[model samples]
Structure formats: structure tokens, C-alpha cells
Target: MAAGGRGSGRPAKKKSPTKGTGGNKRRGLEGRGATPPAHLRHWHKDKARTERVEREERTGGKTSAARPQTRTRRSEDAPEYIGGRNPVLEALRAGVPAAAMYVALRIDNDDRVKEAVRLAAERGIALLEVGREKLDRLTEGGIHQGVALQIPAYEYAHPDDLVSIAQEAGEVPLIVALDSVTDPRNLGAIARSATAFGAHGLLVPSRRSAGVTGGAWKTSAGTLATLTVARASNLTSALREYREAGLFVVGLDGEGSVDLEKANLLDGPLVIVVGSEGKGLSRLVAESCDLVVRIPMHAAAESLNAGVAAGIALYEVARHRRR
Candidate 1:
């Protein structure tokens, strides 16, 4: 209105002078130019995700993407056989302790097969040359790829022992319990996160839970060796046992009455129960919780994966305890 008259309809804005004015008006798309459109903000590719997809494609979807198949039925034995060259090679690469490597007689040498034999001999694992017929039976007639590796069974500790060990160490017990989380990678990630957040150990139900497998070991990136994982016959019963031991049992639910941020009981003995991604905490386990906590999210209907949920809860507990 000051520059023009009141009735003028021109946009009321000042224009910068040309070059040689107070400022160099060399603004002809200078200095990073304009930011791309909002849709272009995500123009940068996610390298990790791209690589994973590429590997999965190269392996015919048989990379870690098929890790659940690794959890597929295996012989119930102290030392179990993992068939397929890729699985065996992958397991060895992940540093899963193996007792021996079985090679089908006159197996053609490939990169992984050669590597497996080399690693077996290097790591002092007995190399057994067996007929394909035996390996066929050992792998339950599944594709063995002329190779198999024997991994020792996972040693599960008693749930009570987790708390007792923490007590003996003079530290408040912090444990994580998993219900119906079937992904071994998720299990391994939880182990890594639990260890990072000072969790004393982890627990999973005896049935319908991911056990420590080669994929899990790889996913943990070696934290699985340091974290004690226990298998509970019944999760509800385990909660009751923890409650009787004078520990607070908190369940992570999306619609619980208590807010995780406001629950300050973490300074004492505690166990956080994380449920499956799709179903959440089971009804019986939810009933056993001393308090059910729902973490505040950035948006409604948004949730974290089981491993991430467990990690965040553990981090919150550790934060409050530190405070």
C-alpha cells in the first residue's frame, strides 16, 4: 500500500536490484539451486535395501530372505545338520560353531563348497565324505547341494537362572521375553538390542518361538554368544514366577492403560514382554502383567517390529534407571 496506491492490485513485494547493487544479484540458479519437489525428497536410493534385493534376486530368493526355512523342521538332536551349500557356507561365515562338515562323495567343487572344505579344515571341524544317499536322509530329502554342516544344539538356561545371575552380580535384573516371534532374525536383533540396553538375558516360549539358529546368529552379529536366552514352557507361568521373585513384569501393548514413558518402575527388577507383530501380547500374558505399557508413537496405527519394540522398551528402562 505504501509502495503503490490502495486500489493497486499488483503484488506488494520488493524486488532485488540487478548486479552491482547492495548485493550481487547473480542469482541465476546459484547456490544449490532450488530444492527438488517434495516428491523428490526421497530421490536418494537406500543402498542397503537395494543390495538386499539384489542378493535375493541373485540367489533366487534363497538368501537371508529364506531364513525362516532355516527354522523349518530339523532333526531333534544335540548336533543338527544344516543342508545346502549356501546354508552351510552362510552358517560358517556367521561363525556358528560347527562340529563337522559333511560333503557328498565326489562333490563338484564350487566357491562355497571349496570355502566350506577349507573352513572346515582350517577351523578343525571334522570333514566327512559321505554318500548322497545318507545326506539325502540326513537332510530329510531336502536339497543338500552336496554339503551339510553340523551345529551344536542351543543350550537354554532356566528363566530363574537369569534373575539369579543378575542378583548375584548385584544388578537389577532386566530381562526380555518374546511371545510368538518366529523370525530368527528378529530374535537375533532383539538379543543385540537387549545386550546394548543392559538387559540381563532374554526369554522365549518353548513352542512357536524362534530358536537360536544360524540365521539368528548372523543377525545378532555375535551378540547371541554373550546374551543368555531362556525358553519358557509357558509365558504366563514365567511371568508369575518373575512376579513371585519380586520383579515387575511389564508387557508392551499398543492399547494398554499405562504409558511407557510414565512407568518409572524400571529402576528395580523388571522383565519386558514383547509380543508378535501381528497379534501383540497374548491375553493370558497380558493379564499377568503388573502393568501394561504402550509406547507413544509419532502417529496412530503405527508400530515397531517385535525386535525394535523390545529394544525401545529396554532403552526406556535403562534411561529411567540411569536417571
Candidate 2:
């Protein structure tokens, strides 16, 4: 074996020269572009914090601290489905605008189902036959009774639009406002009373209040279709706006000083505010009322349900206006 030459331990293999692109390798070796801002980098620890701070700034600190810093906008405008044979028939008879009628396959053809299908067909609504499992899923496990009606999301009018609606109708503004009322049935009942007694529209807070739902539609007996519902971001601010627009704001309270029947303001442009049955009027809302009036009732009654109170107040207002 040679000493300095290739030894018995195995000769070293010859290396081949690597080939290179014209300038591709150089371009790759060159400075990768400038680093992005920390918030733009998904792997950076400060990215979420930076984004949250920016979002807080953009939203004027109105963002929910308890929610995840990453926020998503949810669509509240999605269509709703009301189920049950009686409810479907009632909605159809009340002429509630329906997009479609879904009947479970081989469902019992009851009188209500037949009437609902006939009415829906008359209104040019599409009828779809689905499996019972599909109907259950569509109604979110509600007792569908083999039928369901697809209702479009209720389009709420702006708070200011109620006044304009009254003006266009050539009538003094008569509006009903609900404060902190979460039950859709109460909202629907109040709407029914409001419509019966000549209210131009109904007002509700955007939060902590009920918007039109299937329950509301069923409870209202379809009166919500004829009545306009307005949503306010802040109920107190909406009352102030109504006052500025020359409408008298009245709050229904058990402890009110004025009796609803004798209140002379009822004949004029009015806004009747009804509070939740449990909590009654909130401090800010009670303070915003031009007149806090009470319905005459037995002392043992404690407090009237919000719908009943609104109905009594609206009836008195209607009677007064008729005089």
C-alpha cells in the first residue's frame, strides 16, 4: 500500500462540479424582500396582540374584551324556518311572506297541511318535499309536525324612519318602543296591540331586545307583516330623537305619577315605551320619557305584563284620539 497515495483504507472518490442556472441561484441568495410588519406575520407572538390593539383603536374601544381578539362578523340576516302544521297554516293565512314551503315526505295530509300547501301555492311560493330528517335539521329540532315554512329575515326599519313613515301616512306619529324585552312573544303581542290601536310602527333596541322571529310571527298572528318594526342602537337616544322630532315620549311604569287614561298627551304625536315584565323600565329609559304614566289596576296585581300594559295604554290613546 502507498503511504501518501491512495491507501488501503479505501481511495477517495472524485467530486463532480455542480451546474448552476444563469442567475436563478444568485437571485435566490440575494436579500429576500424586506420583513413584513409583526402583525402581518402569523408566527409572531405579538401578531394577535398587535391586531387586537389596532381593532380596539378602530372600534373606539367598543370591542368585547371577553371574546377572542380575532373577531368574525356573523350574518344575522339569514332566513328563518317555522315548523308545525298549525303554525304553517296560520302563517300562510296571515299572508306572511314565505319563500318556500317544505313538507316531509309521506307526511299525513291533514286539513292544516292541505290549507297551507294550497295557500302557499296560491302565493307562488315554491313547495319542496324533504325527508323528515332533513326537515328536523332545517327546523333545528323544533316540533315540525311534518311541515315548515321558510321566512326571509325581517328587514328592520331605522329608528328615524318610523317618524318619516308617520309623516308619509299623514298621521301623527304613534310609535311603540320596547325596552329590554327579550321575549319574541311579548314583542309580537305588543306589535298586535300597536297595530290594532293605530301605532305607525314599533321600536326595539338592537341588543337585549327581541327582533321578529318565528315565535313572534305566530304570536302576532301575522300582524307583524303589516306593521313596521324599527331597531335602535340605543333606546334612550332613540327616545331623545323622537322628542327632538316633536313626538311626546311616554313610559309605562307601575310607579308612574300620571294615569294613562287621563294623560292629555295621548291624543298628540306619541311614543309609548314598554319595559320588560321583570325589570320594568331601565333608569336611562325612564328618565328619557316625557311622561311616565301608569295603567289603573288593582294593587294586588303588582305589575302588568309588558304586552298587556302596552295594549291598555294604546287602547286609552286610541280612545282619546277618537274623542
Candidate 3:
């Protein structure tokens, strides 16, 4: 046999294990379960953050000094709530329905708290005196101010119902539509004006707009109970429909071509559309309006809040209708 061929396969070299290649750790099926990445953790802690967003978006839900501990559920079945002294008292005054009212044990015996208790008693709603910790859990760590109410989900109506409601009442319908008005307080103020001025119902876009939340309910001072605030899937289409239904569609803008004072459409079925504060009106919605009108204002005050402007417009409509 040849020397190289007989003994040789290059001295049969031995391979050494590489460092940091998971030499000692188990691999494949032998490995233990591992934690998911941060983004993949759907069960991460976000209850407080989520509650904060919802709290801020509420009509009167501005974050107050009283910070609450967050309690939340992923499901939509969880009941709605309003907390803090002013919120609870106003909600009670407005007669917002409540399955239960929770008062913290040894709460400050303040006037608003007293009024809330009295109102709850008068309405025959059960009162549950609970510990601060329990109250915090119930409100999901809101600034409860020793009081809270468990309320039903807000009920929304269809835009078409406004016209039908007016027809059934045998009266000229006056409707107010809000475009991108996201403040709950503004909604409440507008609702108050609508109730005051005999408006048939209110229309709000379903998206990018604030709904009749607890804050709005309390701000309305109970007028929301009698007023029908309808939801519109698309504002432009809703305005067009209002026009086709024999109701005049008027958009309110600071730079409108027509003055609201001399407007002649108040006598018939009408819808006064108010836009958002920052963005005024979207192009599509503005174009759909039959007349774009602006209220007269003196120099210095360039703009009014969406709510204040809506109240003024509603007053003018009511005044003209009465005349």
C-alpha cells in the first residue's frame, strides 16, 4: 500500500466547538418556553394609558387633579362611568341613569357630595358605600372625588330619524349638525341650545367626533334626555340628504360669504352645520352646504368656540322662527 494512501486522510483532523454558539443550552425541542417580544405581548400593562385617553376624550372628561387608578376590560360590555365631585353632582342633577351609585366611605362631606347622595336617594337609586380602594377599582383609578355612577352605554339615533321625528310632530324641523367637533363639553352646550331653541335633533359624525359621553350628559344639565342626538356615518352625504329632504343645509364658517343675520332660510326645515375649531370645515362638507354663513363679530375676537358659535346660531334661528 502506498504510504500516503494507507495512513492518510489528512491526519483525521478533530473539530473544536465554537464559543457563544449555544453550546451548553438546549436547542430545538429540548429548549424551554420563552417570553414573547414586547410588541408581541398583547397582555402588557396599558390599562392606565387606555383609561387616560378615554377620560380625556369624554365631553367634560378633562383630566383633573384627582388622578385615578386604572381599571379596564378589553370587552365593550364594561359599563360607562363619570367621576370627581363636579362630574358626579352634575350627572345626578341631569338625572343620568345609574344601575348603582358608589360613595366612598368617610368621604368629605362637601356640598356637591351631599347633593349627589340626596339626588340618588330621591331617584330611588341604590347607594353603595365602599372603601377608597374599591372605589378606585370601580372607576379604574379615576379621580372619583369619593363618588361615582355606573351608567348605561350612550344610545345613538340615525340621521334619518331626525326628519321623521319632525314630521310626526307636525312642526318645521330645526336640526344642528357638527362636523369634527370632538369636544364633549361642546356637544353638551350645543345640546342645551338645541333643547332651548326647539331644534328637532342633533347630528354628529360617527368618527373623529365626540359622542354623548357622561361629561356631555352632565353638561347638558339633563336636556340630553329629551333631545335626540343622531349619528351620521358620512357628513357630506348627510348634508346632501338633508338638502334633498327639503331642509336647507347651512354651514357656519368665519369666512363664509353670507352673513347669518339676514339669512332667510330659518323659517323652513333647516340644518345649521358647525365645523371644527382648528380645521373649520372639510372641503367636501363645505361644498355640500347650500349656504355658508358667518355670524357678525367685532374686531379683536377672531374666533368663538364651536359651542359658543352654535348657541348663537341656535338663538338666531329660534328668534327668527318666533317672528
Candidate 4:
């Protein structure tokens, strides 16, 4: 009989054992630690939704919410669709660059709708007729009033480019910088005032600040089209850069030592930083300013709106420049 042959009647010689798997079998028996939380489990069906809710809660709604199951969130640079008849009509009148217009089929025609359609046609904007459900979805359930207009994202100029713009125009640069202002309407109003008062452009922090939106466009009364808005990654750094460029960084603070009228810095290349309505200038932003000036107010008045404050400051600056 052969040694180690199968079904051998004689006892076979014992074979030497092979190398072990180094505890792999034991590790596999242990399982993958304890199961992670539902929100952290990638394979869980509700993991994404649980994570989104938790994130929103953690951020106190500062972060944008997860997109609806019906639609994905639009990119930052994507065109915005403003709903409501008045907004649509006004956007068209303001010459907001439009890619297309969406009108609900069988909508009750009103004067605003008629005018919007006419303006869109005149401007060569594509008119898309969609069902009410689709229009609602597109507008994100906003009060669309059966109409929506898709406008291109506002093109922002560079902070340095604004200085160059003023230099090219042979004018002392007067730039408006927003510290923490988050309201698009306030931005629009400030832009209107800036344009009226001869500001070169607007500066806003890229985060925690408002950008050009439909609300801003409507509030500006089309003035935004004429004025350039620039985004700064860091408002303080941008202010420092302006200072190095031979520009005065003036911040509007209620506790400012110098009065707006008394501050002689507005006559030169200047950047006026207006803080949020509730909170004046942030500490870093206030410190970055070459001077902090306050608008004169009656003792009875607690605080002024950011838009109004900026308007007054800009007007005073414009007055100084004129003289």
C-alpha cells in the first residue's frame, strides 16, 4: 500500500501541520466591532436622512438643508428661479439676465403675467409652459402665483478689480464692504445707495454674508445691474489689502469714537464696512478698519438699519468727495 493513500487499510504516517492564518479566523468570528449608530452606518436605508437631520440640528440651521427627494439641490453657480408674478415681472423689468421663463399651463392670466410674458419675449428669453405641479416643484413650493423666471447667477467682480475700475475711471475709489450683513434686501438697498452715491463697487464676505439674489435685485430696483458686487474670502484680510493699496478702511460702529461727518478719511480711496443690523461690526472687522465712525443718531433711537446706515454714510462720503 502506498503511504498516505486514500482508503488505505494500514495506518498512514501523520502529515506535518501547515502555517496558521495568524488569528484571521478568530478576528472574523469577533464581527465588525459593535454596530455603528444608524446615522453613521453607510448601508442603512435611513442613514443619509438621519445624518442630514443631525447635521442641520448641530448647525442650528446655518447650513443648508438636504435637498428634497423630488429634486437635488442646485449648485451655487446655477441659475435661480424666482417665483411669484410680481417678482417675475419685476425681474424682467430690472433686466435680470434670464435663461428661461416658466409659466404654469392653464394659469389664470393677469396683467403681471401678460407683461412678464411680453418682456420675456422681447428679451428673447425662452418661455417654457409646464404643469402646475412641475412649476411648484421648480419654485420649491414658493408662492409662485403660476409664474417663475430663471435668472443667471450674478457675476461677482474681484476686490482688486474694483480698485482698478475706479482707477480706470479716474475717480477716487469708494467701496462698500459688508461685515456680517445676511439679508439680500439690505444688500440690494445698500447697492442702490452705493450707486446713487458714486461707489465703485460692493464688497462682502463670501460666507455669512448675502449675495446677489432675486430679493436683492428687486430691492435694488435694478441698480444692482449697474453696480458690481465682489466677494472676499476674509473680510478682514480684504480690508488689510485695501489699506496696503492706499485706501482707508472705515467701519460703521455705534461706539465709534469719531462721527461719520467728522471722519476726514472718506475723501480718499475708501472702504466703508457696514456691519449687520443687530450686531455692529465684528471684532476682527472693526479692528481691521483704519477708523471706526458712527452715524449721528438721536438719543431716542437705539440703532439704525444696516441699509439706512450705509446709505447715510455713503451720502456723507459722496458729499465730502464733491467738495
Top of the candidates by TM-score: 2
Cα RMSD to the true fold for all candidates = 23.9, 11.1, 11.3, 13.5
lDDT of 1 by residue, 166-241 (tens): 9888998999999889998799889889989888899989998898865566567667767899988898998998
Arranged by TM-score, best first: 2, 4, 3, 1
Task: Give the higher-TM-score candidate: 1 or 3.
Answer: 3
Q: Which prediction has more favorable lDDT, 1 or 3?
A: 3
Estimate the TM-score of every prediction: 0.62, 0.74, 0.72, 0.73
* lDDT per residue as tens, model 3, 86-177: 87777777677777788888888888988888999999988989888867765667678888887777778999999999999999988999
For model 2, give the 10-residue run with minimal summed lDDT: 53-62
Between the candidate structures 1 and 2, which one is better when assessed by lDDT?
A: 2
- Those runs of model 4 whose alpha carbons end farther than 4 Å from true positions after fitting are 1-74, 106-111, 131-143
Per-residue lDDT value at 114 in model 2: 86
Task: Give the clash count for model 3.
Answer: 7
In model 1, where is the ten-residue run with the lowest total lDDT?
A: 69-78
lDDT per residue for candidate 2 within 1-323, as digits (tens), equals 67535666766668898886989888989887999987678778577776765454334345666665465432366567788888788788878889989998998898888888899989999999988987776676888899989888899999889889889989988999999989988998998899898899999999989889877886787788899999989899999989998999999988889888879798999999999896789999999999998878887888888888889999898899998
